[model samples]
Target: MKAIVKLVILLFCVTAFSQGQQHVEYKKVSNNLIKATYYFADNSNAIQSEGFFNDKNQLQGMWVSYDTEGNKTIIAYYDKGKKVGVWTYFKDDKINFVTYKDNKLIGVEEKALVVN
Candidate 1:
Protein backbone atom coordinates (compact mmCIF):
# COMPACT_ATOMS: atom_id res chain seq x y z
CA MET A 1 0.00 0.00 0.00
CA LYS A 2 2.86 2.37 0.79
CA ALA A 3 4.45 1.68 -2.56
CA ILE A 4 1.12 2.23 -4.33
CA VAL A 5 0.64 5.52 -2.53
CA LYS A 6 4.02 6.68 -3.71
CA LEU A 7 2.96 6.04 -7.30
CA VAL A 8 1.50 8.82 -9.47
CA ILE A 9 -2.05 9.92 -8.58
CA LEU A 10 -3.33 13.28 -9.58
CA LEU A 11 -6.71 15.52 -10.36
CA PHE A 12 -9.79 16.52 -12.22
CA CYS A 13 -12.60 18.49 -10.62
CA VAL A 14 -15.45 16.03 -9.98
CA THR A 15 -17.53 18.34 -7.83
CA ALA A 16 -19.82 19.85 -10.43
CA PHE A 17 -20.40 16.55 -12.20
CA SER A 18 -21.19 14.74 -8.98
CA GLN A 19 -23.74 17.33 -7.90
CA GLY A 20 -26.59 15.21 -9.18
CA GLN A 21 -25.21 12.35 -7.15
CA GLN A 22 -27.14 13.70 -4.21
CA HIS A 23 -29.70 11.09 -5.20
CA VAL A 24 -27.24 8.20 -5.00
CA GLU A 25 -28.30 5.28 -2.89
CA TYR A 26 -26.54 3.94 0.18
CA LYS A 27 -27.39 1.54 2.97
CA LYS A 28 -26.37 1.22 6.60
CA VAL A 29 -23.82 -1.44 7.37
CA SER A 30 -22.88 -3.33 10.55
CA ASN A 31 -20.58 -0.48 11.48
CA ASN A 32 -23.54 1.87 11.26
CA LEU A 33 -21.84 3.62 8.39
CA ILE A 34 -23.32 4.04 4.94
CA LYS A 35 -22.19 1.70 2.18
CA ALA A 36 -23.21 3.09 -1.15
CA THR A 37 -23.41 1.39 -4.52
CA TYR A 38 -24.81 3.35 -7.38
CA TYR A 39 -26.21 1.44 -10.33
CA PHE A 40 -26.34 1.92 -14.04
CA ALA A 41 -29.68 3.46 -14.92
CA ASP A 42 -30.03 0.99 -17.74
CA ASN A 43 -31.30 -2.56 -17.44
CA SER A 44 -27.86 -4.12 -17.14
CA ASN A 45 -28.07 -3.82 -13.35
CA ALA A 46 -24.35 -3.10 -13.30
CA ILE A 47 -22.76 -1.15 -10.51
CA GLN A 48 -21.90 2.37 -11.50
CA SER A 49 -20.06 3.35 -8.35
CA GLU A 50 -19.35 2.16 -4.82
CA GLY A 51 -17.93 3.64 -1.62
CA PHE A 52 -18.43 4.12 2.06
CA PHE A 53 -19.44 7.20 3.98
CA ASN A 54 -18.36 8.02 7.50
CA ASP A 55 -20.73 8.60 10.39
CA LYS A 56 -20.80 12.26 9.54
CA ASN A 57 -21.98 11.46 6.01
CA GLN A 58 -18.57 12.13 4.56
CA LEU A 59 -17.07 9.89 1.87
CA GLN A 60 -14.14 7.81 3.06
CA GLY A 61 -11.85 5.10 1.83
CA MET A 62 -11.54 3.88 -1.74
CA TRP A 63 -14.27 4.93 -4.12
CA VAL A 64 -14.63 3.26 -7.49
CA SER A 65 -16.65 4.23 -10.55
CA TYR A 66 -17.41 2.30 -13.71
CA ASP A 67 -18.13 3.40 -17.21
CA THR A 68 -21.39 2.58 -19.01
CA GLU A 69 -19.80 -0.41 -20.67
CA GLY A 70 -18.64 -1.74 -17.29
CA ASN A 71 -15.05 -0.58 -17.62
CA LYS A 72 -13.53 1.02 -14.55
CA THR A 73 -13.54 4.77 -15.00
CA ILE A 74 -11.85 5.93 -11.87
CA ILE A 75 -10.42 4.92 -8.53
CA ALA A 76 -10.35 7.72 -6.00
CA TYR A 77 -9.71 8.17 -2.30
CA TYR A 78 -11.29 10.53 0.14
CA ASP A 79 -11.18 11.41 3.81
CA LYS A 80 -14.20 13.10 5.34
CA GLY A 81 -15.50 13.83 1.83
CA LYS A 82 -12.39 15.75 0.87
CA LYS A 83 -10.34 14.38 -2.02
CA VAL A 84 -7.09 13.21 -0.52
CA GLY A 85 -4.23 10.95 -1.57
CA VAL A 86 -4.19 9.16 -4.90
CA TRP A 87 -6.88 9.26 -7.58
CA THR A 88 -6.74 7.45 -10.90
CA TYR A 89 -8.69 8.13 -14.08
CA PHE A 90 -8.99 5.74 -17.02
CA LYS A 91 -9.49 6.53 -20.67
CA ASP A 92 -8.92 4.73 -23.92
CA ASP A 93 -5.43 3.31 -23.71
CA LYS A 94 -4.53 6.10 -21.34
CA ILE A 95 -4.38 6.38 -17.60
CA ASN A 96 -4.09 9.56 -15.56
CA PHE A 97 -3.09 9.74 -11.94
CA VAL A 98 -3.80 12.61 -9.63
CA THR A 99 -2.34 13.17 -6.20
CA TYR A 100 -4.05 15.42 -3.74
CA LYS A 101 -3.39 16.82 -0.28
CA ASP A 102 -6.25 18.42 1.61
CA ASN A 103 -8.24 18.64 -1.63
CA LYS A 104 -5.42 20.37 -3.47
CA LEU A 105 -3.71 18.73 -6.43
CA ILE A 106 -0.05 17.92 -5.68
CA GLY A 107 1.07 16.04 -8.77
CA VAL A 108 0.02 14.33 -12.01
CA GLU A 109 1.18 11.50 -14.28
CA GLU A 110 -0.26 10.00 -17.45
CA LYS A 111 0.60 6.70 -19.02
CA ALA A 112 -0.74 3.74 -20.94
CA LEU A 113 -3.76 2.15 -19.33
CA VAL A 114 -2.63 -1.24 -18.17
CA VAL A 115 -4.95 -4.09 -17.21
CA ASN A 116 -3.84 -7.29 -15.61
Candidate 2:
Protein backbone atom coordinates (compact mmCIF):
# COMPACT_ATOMS: atom_id res chain seq x y z
CA MET A 1 0.00 0.00 0.00
CA LYS A 2 2.79 2.40 0.85
CA ALA A 3 4.53 1.74 -2.49
CA ILE A 4 1.32 2.40 -4.39
CA VAL A 5 0.80 5.65 -2.47
CA LYS A 6 4.35 6.80 -3.28
CA LEU A 7 3.86 6.03 -6.98
CA VAL A 8 0.65 8.02 -7.07
CA ILE A 9 2.31 11.00 -5.37
CA LEU A 10 5.21 10.89 -7.84
CA LEU A 11 2.84 10.84 -10.79
CA PHE A 12 0.92 13.81 -9.40
CA CYS A 13 4.12 15.79 -8.92
CA VAL A 14 5.26 15.13 -12.46
CA THR A 15 1.97 16.25 -13.95
CA ALA A 16 1.91 19.36 -11.81
CA PHE A 17 5.27 20.56 -13.12
CA SER A 18 4.67 19.66 -16.74
CA GLN A 19 3.83 22.58 -19.02
CA GLY A 20 2.28 22.90 -22.42
CA GLN A 21 4.59 23.31 -25.40
CA GLN A 22 5.24 26.80 -26.70
CA HIS A 23 4.93 27.53 -30.40
CA VAL A 24 5.35 30.21 -33.00
CA GLU A 25 2.96 31.08 -35.79
CA TYR A 26 4.11 32.81 -38.93
CA LYS A 27 2.08 34.61 -41.57
CA LYS A 28 3.08 36.34 -44.72
CA VAL A 29 1.91 39.93 -44.76
CA SER A 30 3.59 41.30 -47.89
CA ASN A 31 6.21 40.41 -50.42
CA ASN A 32 8.87 41.61 -48.05
CA LEU A 33 7.30 41.04 -44.69
CA ILE A 34 6.33 38.06 -42.57
CA LYS A 35 4.71 38.35 -39.19
CA ALA A 36 5.78 36.01 -36.41
CA THR A 37 4.07 35.52 -33.12
CA TYR A 38 5.42 33.39 -30.28
CA TYR A 39 2.99 31.95 -27.78
CA PHE A 40 3.45 30.98 -24.18
CA ALA A 41 4.04 27.38 -23.15
CA ASP A 42 1.37 27.29 -20.48
CA ASN A 43 -1.52 27.34 -22.98
CA SER A 44 -2.61 30.74 -21.71
CA ASN A 45 -3.07 32.17 -25.21
CA ALA A 46 -0.51 34.80 -24.31
CA ILE A 47 2.01 36.08 -26.77
CA GLN A 48 5.65 36.21 -25.81
CA SER A 49 6.73 38.26 -28.81
CA GLU A 50 5.27 39.52 -32.05
CA GLY A 51 7.19 41.09 -34.88
CA PHE A 52 7.76 41.27 -38.59
CA PHE A 53 10.62 39.88 -40.56
CA ASN A 54 11.81 41.09 -43.91
CA ASP A 55 12.41 38.97 -46.99
CA LYS A 56 16.00 38.57 -45.90
CA ASN A 57 14.82 37.22 -42.54
CA GLN A 58 15.88 40.46 -40.92
CA LEU A 59 13.90 42.08 -38.16
CA GLN A 60 11.61 44.79 -39.49
CA GLY A 61 8.68 46.93 -38.46
CA MET A 62 7.42 46.97 -34.86
CA TRP A 63 8.42 44.33 -32.33
CA VAL A 64 6.75 43.84 -28.99
CA SER A 65 7.56 41.51 -26.10
CA TYR A 66 5.38 40.68 -23.15
CA ASP A 67 5.83 38.98 -19.84
CA THR A 68 4.28 35.65 -19.05
CA GLU A 69 1.34 37.44 -17.50
CA GLY A 70 0.67 39.29 -20.79
CA ASN A 71 2.14 42.60 -19.63
CA LYS A 72 4.05 44.49 -22.25
CA THR A 73 7.72 44.51 -21.29
CA ILE A 74 9.35 46.03 -24.33
CA ILE A 75 8.33 47.84 -27.51
CA ALA A 76 10.85 48.33 -30.29
CA TYR A 77 10.98 49.44 -33.90
CA TYR A 78 13.25 48.40 -36.68
CA ASP A 79 13.83 49.22 -40.33
CA LYS A 80 15.70 46.81 -42.56
CA GLY A 81 17.19 45.23 -39.44
CA LYS A 82 18.45 48.61 -38.22
CA LYS A 83 17.08 50.04 -35.03
CA VAL A 84 14.92 53.12 -35.69
CA GLY A 85 12.38 55.24 -33.88
CA VAL A 86 11.69 54.96 -30.17
CA TRP A 87 11.99 51.84 -28.05
CA THR A 88 10.17 51.61 -24.78
CA TYR A 89 11.22 49.37 -21.90
CA PHE A 90 9.23 48.65 -18.78
CA LYS A 91 11.31 47.97 -15.68
CA ASP A 92 9.78 47.67 -12.28
CA ASP A 93 7.92 50.95 -11.66
CA LYS A 94 9.63 52.88 -14.44
CA ILE A 95 9.14 53.24 -18.15
CA ASN A 96 12.12 54.12 -20.28
CA PHE A 97 11.90 55.50 -23.78
CA VAL A 98 15.00 55.36 -25.94
CA THR A 99 15.30 56.94 -29.34
CA TYR A 100 17.44 55.55 -32.08
CA LYS A 101 18.38 56.92 -35.48
CA ASP A 102 20.13 54.65 -37.95
CA ASN A 103 20.86 52.27 -35.06
CA LYS A 104 22.50 55.11 -33.12
CA LEU A 105 21.26 56.26 -29.77
CA ILE A 106 19.78 59.74 -30.10
CA GLY A 107 17.95 60.44 -26.85
CA VAL A 108 16.41 58.88 -23.77
CA GLU A 109 13.37 59.61 -21.66
CA GLU A 110 12.05 58.10 -18.46
CA LYS A 111 8.71 58.27 -16.71
CA ALA A 112 7.13 56.77 -13.65
CA LEU A 113 4.55 54.08 -14.21
CA VAL A 114 1.07 54.90 -13.09
CA VAL A 115 -1.07 52.12 -11.73
CA ASN A 116 -4.82 52.34 -11.75
Candidate 3:
Protein backbone atom coordinates (compact mmCIF):
# COMPACT_ATOMS: atom_id res chain seq x y z
CA MET A 1 0.00 0.00 0.00
CA LYS A 2 1.02 3.61 -0.43
CA ALA A 3 1.09 4.04 3.33
CA ILE A 4 3.44 1.13 3.76
CA VAL A 5 5.72 2.41 1.03
CA LYS A 6 5.81 5.87 2.59
CA LEU A 7 6.65 4.40 5.96
CA VAL A 8 9.51 2.42 4.54
CA ILE A 9 10.88 5.45 2.79
CA LEU A 10 10.72 7.47 5.95
CA LEU A 11 12.53 4.82 7.92
CA PHE A 12 15.22 4.54 5.31
CA CYS A 13 15.81 8.27 5.29
CA VAL A 14 15.96 8.44 9.03
CA THR A 15 18.44 5.61 9.24
CA ALA A 16 20.64 7.07 6.57
CA PHE A 17 20.72 10.50 8.16
CA SER A 18 21.31 9.14 11.63
CA GLN A 19 24.41 7.26 10.54
CA GLY A 20 27.56 9.26 9.98
CA GLN A 21 31.17 8.36 9.27
CA GLN A 22 33.65 8.57 12.12
CA HIS A 23 37.12 9.92 11.49
CA VAL A 24 40.44 10.58 13.23
CA GLU A 25 43.20 13.03 12.63
CA TYR A 26 46.85 12.89 13.71
CA LYS A 27 49.27 15.73 13.49
CA LYS A 28 52.85 16.08 14.58
CA VAL A 29 53.50 18.82 17.08
CA SER A 30 56.52 20.30 18.75
CA ASN A 31 58.54 18.25 21.26
CA ASN A 32 58.16 15.07 19.27
CA LEU A 33 54.51 14.64 20.03
CA ILE A 34 51.68 13.40 17.85
CA LYS A 35 48.34 14.99 18.52
CA ALA A 36 45.38 12.75 17.78
CA THR A 37 41.78 13.79 17.53
CA TYR A 38 38.78 11.52 17.12
CA TYR A 39 35.42 12.68 15.84
CA PHE A 40 31.99 11.20 16.39
CA ALA A 41 30.10 9.69 13.49
CA ASP A 42 27.01 11.79 14.03
CA ASN A 43 26.21 14.51 11.50
CA SER A 44 27.56 17.19 13.83
CA ASN A 45 31.12 15.77 13.60
CA ALA A 46 31.73 16.56 17.24
CA ILE A 47 34.94 15.61 18.95
CA GLN A 48 34.76 12.34 20.83
CA SER A 49 38.38 12.00 22.01
CA GLU A 50 41.64 13.86 21.87
CA GLY A 51 45.11 13.08 23.09
CA PHE A 52 48.78 13.02 22.37
CA PHE A 53 51.31 10.33 21.67
CA ASN A 54 55.05 10.33 21.88
CA ASP A 55 57.36 9.53 19.03
CA LYS A 56 57.26 5.89 20.03
CA ASN A 57 53.51 5.79 19.81
CA GLN A 58 53.16 5.86 23.58
CA LEU A 59 50.29 7.77 25.11
CA GLN A 60 51.55 10.95 26.74
CA GLY A 61 50.39 14.26 28.10
CA MET A 62 46.72 15.16 28.47
CA TRP A 63 43.81 13.20 27.05
CA VAL A 64 40.14 13.95 27.00
CA SER A 65 36.96 12.19 25.96
CA TYR A 66 33.48 13.43 25.29
CA ASP A 67 30.10 11.81 24.99
CA THR A 68 27.81 11.86 22.01
CA GLU A 69 26.20 15.02 23.35
CA GLY A 70 29.63 16.69 23.38
CA ASN A 71 29.88 16.73 27.14
CA LYS A 72 33.28 16.11 28.67
CA THR A 73 33.29 12.60 30.05
CA ILE A 74 36.88 12.02 31.13
CA ILE A 75 40.08 13.96 31.54
CA ALA A 76 43.30 12.02 31.95
CA TYR A 77 47.04 12.41 31.72
CA TYR A 78 50.05 10.26 31.05
CA ASP A 79 53.80 10.40 31.33
CA LYS A 80 55.92 8.26 29.03
CA GLY A 81 52.96 5.96 28.51
CA LYS A 82 52.35 5.69 32.24
CA LYS A 83 49.22 7.07 33.82
CA VAL A 84 49.98 10.05 36.06
CA GLY A 85 48.31 13.10 37.58
CA VAL A 86 44.62 13.48 38.30
CA TRP A 87 41.86 12.26 36.04
CA THR A 88 38.29 13.46 36.15
CA TYR A 89 35.26 11.40 35.18
CA PHE A 90 31.84 12.82 34.62
CA LYS A 91 28.89 10.61 35.45
CA ASP A 92 25.18 11.06 35.02
CA ASP A 93 24.74 12.48 38.50
CA LYS A 94 28.25 12.80 39.86
CA ILE A 95 31.88 13.58 39.13
CA ASN A 96 34.92 11.54 40.11
CA PHE A 97 38.50 12.65 40.47
CA VAL A 98 41.09 9.89 40.37
CA THR A 99 44.76 10.37 40.96
CA TYR A 100 47.43 8.18 39.49
CA LYS A 101 51.16 7.82 39.91
CA ASP A 102 53.28 5.61 37.72
CA ASN A 103 50.10 4.02 36.40
CA LYS A 104 48.88 3.19 39.89
CA LEU A 105 45.77 4.64 41.46
CA ILE A 106 46.74 6.91 44.31
CA GLY A 107 43.47 8.51 45.39
CA VAL A 108 39.88 9.09 44.38
CA GLU A 109 37.28 11.70 45.17
CA GLU A 110 33.65 11.92 44.10
CA LYS A 111 31.25 14.82 44.09
CA ALA A 112 27.61 15.17 43.20
CA LEU A 113 26.73 16.84 39.96
CA VAL A 114 24.95 20.09 40.71
CA VAL A 115 22.78 21.99 38.28
CA ASN A 116 21.59 25.53 38.78
Candidate 4:
Protein backbone atom coordinates (compact mmCIF):
# COMPACT_ATOMS: atom_id res chain seq x y z
CA MET A 1 0.00 0.00 0.00
CA LYS A 2 1.06 3.65 -0.31
CA ALA A 3 1.13 4.11 3.47
CA ILE A 4 3.47 1.14 3.96
CA VAL A 5 5.83 2.39 1.27
CA LYS A 6 5.96 5.84 2.85
CA LEU A 7 6.79 4.31 6.23
CA VAL A 8 9.57 2.19 4.72
CA ILE A 9 11.11 5.22 3.03
CA LEU A 10 10.94 7.20 6.27
CA LEU A 11 12.65 4.42 8.19
CA PHE A 12 15.41 4.11 5.59
CA CYS A 13 16.12 7.84 5.70
CA VAL A 14 16.26 7.85 9.48
CA THR A 15 18.67 4.94 9.57
CA ALA A 16 20.95 6.46 6.99
CA PHE A 17 21.00 9.78 8.83
CA SER A 18 21.81 8.05 12.14
CA GLN A 19 24.78 6.18 10.66
CA GLY A 20 26.08 9.31 8.95
CA GLN A 21 26.31 11.06 12.33
CA GLN A 22 29.07 8.73 13.52
CA HIS A 23 31.66 10.17 11.19
CA VAL A 24 34.54 12.12 12.78
CA GLU A 25 35.72 15.57 11.73
CA TYR A 26 39.34 16.64 11.49
CA LYS A 27 40.31 20.29 11.25
CA LYS A 28 43.75 21.38 10.22
CA VAL A 29 45.55 23.61 12.74
CA SER A 30 48.30 24.73 10.35
CA ASN A 31 50.06 23.51 7.24
CA ASN A 32 51.22 20.44 9.18
CA LEU A 33 48.94 20.36 12.26
CA ILE A 34 45.56 18.64 12.52
CA LYS A 35 43.03 17.97 15.26
CA ALA A 36 40.18 15.50 15.48
CA THR A 37 36.88 16.97 16.59
CA TYR A 38 34.59 14.30 17.97
CA TYR A 39 30.83 14.19 18.07
CA PHE A 40 28.11 12.02 19.52
CA ALA A 41 25.73 9.99 17.38
CA ASP A 42 23.24 12.82 17.81
CA ASN A 43 25.88 15.26 16.50
CA SER A 44 26.64 16.81 19.88
CA ASN A 45 30.13 18.07 20.65
CA ALA A 46 32.15 15.39 22.44
CA ILE A 47 35.87 16.22 22.71
CA GLN A 48 38.82 17.48 20.73
CA SER A 49 42.55 16.67 20.71
CA GLU A 50 45.34 18.95 19.59
CA GLY A 51 47.54 17.04 17.15
CA PHE A 52 51.21 17.97 17.03
CA PHE A 53 53.33 18.15 13.92
CA ASN A 54 56.88 18.46 12.72
CA ASP A 55 58.39 20.51 9.91
CA LYS A 56 58.19 17.56 7.55
CA ASN A 57 54.52 16.89 8.43
CA GLN A 58 55.52 14.29 10.98
CA LEU A 59 53.46 14.19 14.18
CA GLN A 60 54.82 14.41 17.73
CA GLY A 61 53.69 14.74 21.39
CA MET A 62 50.45 13.77 23.16
CA TRP A 63 47.60 12.23 21.21
CA VAL A 64 44.41 11.63 23.14
CA SER A 65 41.76 8.93 22.74
CA TYR A 66 38.26 8.98 24.11
CA ASP A 67 35.48 6.48 24.68
CA THR A 68 32.18 6.59 22.82
CA GLU A 69 30.59 7.25 26.21
CA GLY A 70 32.55 10.55 26.17
CA ASN A 71 35.18 9.47 28.63
CA LYS A 72 38.91 9.77 28.02
CA THR A 73 40.45 6.36 27.38
CA ILE A 74 44.10 7.22 26.97
CA ILE A 75 46.63 10.05 26.93
CA ALA A 76 49.27 8.74 24.57
CA TYR A 77 52.50 10.69 24.20
CA TYR A 78 54.28 10.17 20.92
CA ASP A 79 57.36 11.04 18.95
CA LYS A 80 56.11 11.27 15.36
CA GLY A 81 52.86 9.68 16.60
CA LYS A 82 54.89 6.80 17.98
CA LYS A 83 54.27 5.82 21.57
CA VAL A 84 56.58 7.58 24.02
CA GLY A 85 56.60 8.58 27.67
CA VAL A 86 53.60 7.82 29.87
CA TRP A 87 50.76 6.16 27.95
CA THR A 88 47.68 6.07 30.13
CA TYR A 89 44.63 3.79 29.99
CA PHE A 90 41.47 4.49 31.89
CA LYS A 91 38.43 2.35 32.83
CA ASP A 92 35.86 3.47 35.36
CA ASP A 93 37.99 5.24 38.03
CA LYS A 94 41.10 3.20 37.42
CA ILE A 95 44.15 4.32 35.46
CA ASN A 96 47.05 2.29 34.14
CA PHE A 97 50.29 3.44 32.60
CA VAL A 98 52.95 2.16 30.25
CA THR A 99 56.16 4.09 29.61
CA TYR A 100 57.56 4.09 26.14
CA LYS A 101 60.01 5.85 23.88
CA ASP A 102 60.38 5.77 20.10
CA ASN A 103 57.53 3.17 20.01
CA LYS A 104 59.23 0.84 22.47
CA LEU A 105 57.68 -0.11 25.79
CA ILE A 106 59.91 0.58 28.76
CA GLY A 107 57.69 -0.13 31.78
CA VAL A 108 54.09 -0.62 32.91
CA GLU A 109 52.22 0.25 36.10
CA GLU A 110 48.58 -0.13 37.04
CA LYS A 111 46.71 1.57 39.84
CA ALA A 112 43.41 3.12 40.70
CA LEU A 113 43.96 6.85 41.08
CA VAL A 114 40.45 7.67 42.17
CA VAL A 115 37.88 6.22 44.55
CA ASN A 116 34.27 7.27 44.67
Enumerate clash totals for all models, in the order shown.
6, 0, 0, 0
Report the candidate with higher lDDT, 1 versus 3.
3
Task: Candidate 2: count the clashes.
Answer: 0
Q: Give the winner by TM-score.
A: 3
User: Would you estimate the TM-scores of all the predictions?
Assistant: 0.71, 0.74, 0.76, 0.63
Q: Which ten contiguous residues of candidate 3 have the minimum total lDDT?
A: 38-47
Model 1 C-alpha lDDT per residue in residues 22-113, reported as the tens digit of each score: 34577888574689988865533678899999998898889999987788999999998899988999989899999999899999999996
Q: After superposition, how far is residue 33 of candidate 4 from its true place, in Å?
A: 2.0
Residue 50 CA displacement from its true place in model 3, Å? 0.3
- Stretches off by above 4 angstroms in model 2 are 1-22, 42-44
Ranking by lDDT: 2, 3, 1, 4
Ordered by TM-score, highest first, the candidates read 3, 2, 1, 4
RMSD in angstroms, candidate 1? 17.0
Give the Cα lDDT of each candidate.
0.82, 0.93, 0.93, 0.73
Off by over 4 Å in 1: 1-25, 114-116
TM-score of 2: 0.74
lDDT of 4 by residue, 70-89 (tens): 67888887677677889888
Better of 1 and 2 by lDDT: 2
| Number of the candidate with higher lDDT, 2 or 3 | 2
